[model samples]
Target: MFKENMHTKVGFEMNINKDDVTAPDVIALLQDHLKSMTLCSPPESIHALNTDRLRQPDVTLWSAREDGVLLGCGALKELNSRHGELKSMKTSPQHVRKGVAKRILHHIIEEAKRRGYQRLSLETGSVEAFLPARLLYEKAGFQYCEPFGDYNEDPNSLFMTLNMR
Candidate 1:
């Protein structure tokens, strides 16, 4: 297990890696967390992310584990030159507001920066249930914008982007 020390809170030893995740693994985590979440209502479609379309080599899959226990997970999908997309960002309900998502977000963002991605973009739900996620993204310097990649105008979705340049 990988560990990173937090300022005061003892960070969990969560090893974010590629092969530790599967479609059912993601489904279980999300079904538990987003069942009643206002932000991520109807999380069933999220299962598709584990499919080949979203799990190709261009996509980087990550999961946080504590003592070999899975805690949370997220993914980064490289879109094109200098751009990347955030996908499947979810924290265990047990670890909500406990810096799990933040850690994963920072890890993915740092990976993107390391890979010379000039920009990072994300698509999240616009419902009230998703406020915490939106706040997290905003605090990470994500700003409102039109949908990136294949997304267009969507009332149910909120799109944001950050320039790493």
Candidate 2:
């Protein structure tokens, strides 16, 4: 349940559910997320997953909805027994700045902990358009780090990781 605030509706009740990445609305939002990423970084630097790839067994996608309205979504991909990666994370355009992403992020972190992941990592753009995302991760204790797993160094990309201990 979200607190009633200036940005949220009076009876804001958010449900973060494990999604299959097949719903039409979820697909549309993911498309928009990919489109927005293309505008900010080159194709090689873009890491947001498409619907098909997000359905892989190693990945889990969660969507946040309030009163049946989609607010945002995020994904976690297990890298190994002790590691995980933050994949696609996007807030609906109308719901941006309404604490949607933050809540989803918190949910992801808790899930990672529950899964016994020792670390959670992510790759995001390094451009100004990604400032808000970078700040959000930083606020959640994610520290800048080197590329992990199958990634390589790229000027247009920034990698971060949180030590779960």
Candidate 3:
């Protein structure tokens, strides 16, 4: 089902819906995220998964649209029965600082809890361009944590987790 939230300040209809990740708008946003990541980190240090990987059975992707325009997207990958990893969070350039990311993130966290996950975690870059994202996660109650899932210690990565239980 498509869940919607109207932003009072913007007076626009924003909807968060589970998406197939193949729609043109979704692909464009994912591409933008990939391009931005490549600019900020080397190939080896970049861990953002491609579309094919995100289509796997364990991942559930969502896209946020405002008045039928794509605003952002994110995914939640089931790491285990009680754990999940947030992935591929990206807000469109025009939508940045307009609460799109926060809405998408809130949706992902709620979905994780609904699935009975005890914790949710994510790995993001440790660069200046990523400071806003780090702050967003921190504001959402995610705290620093050691590397999770298949992740290893990397100087260029910052891992964070939220306890859902």
Cα shift from native, residue 18, model 2 (Å): 0.3
> Which sections of candidate 1 miss by over 4 Å?
1-8, 23-27, 30-48
lDDT by residue (1-165, candidate 2, tens digit) is 212233455566789999998889999999999999989898988889989999999999999998889999999999999999998999999999878998899899989999999999999999999999999899899999999999999999999999999
Lowest summed lDDT over 10 consecutive residues: which window, candidate 2? 1-10
Q: Estimate, for each residue in 9-119, the C-alpha lDDT of model 3 and write its tens digit.
A: 557668999998899889888988999999999888798878888889999999998788999999999999999999999999998877888899989998998999999
Candidate 2: C-alpha lDDT: 0.92
Q: lDDT of candidate 3 vs native?
A: 0.90
Model 1, 1-165: lDDT tens digits are 223345315654566676434557665874554444433545532322644544577877788777776678888888996999988787877767667788888888889899899999998877887788899898888899997788877677788998898
Name the best candidate (by lDDT). Answer: 2
Task: Flag regions of model 2 displaced more than 4 Å.
Answer: 1-9
Q: Could you give the candidate ranking by lDDT, starting with the highest? A: 2, 3, 1
Residue-level lDDT for 72 in candidate 2: 97
For each candidate, the alpha-carbon lDDT, in order, equals 0.74, 0.92, 0.90
- In model 3, the worst 10-residue window by lDDT is 1-10
Collision pairs in model 3: none
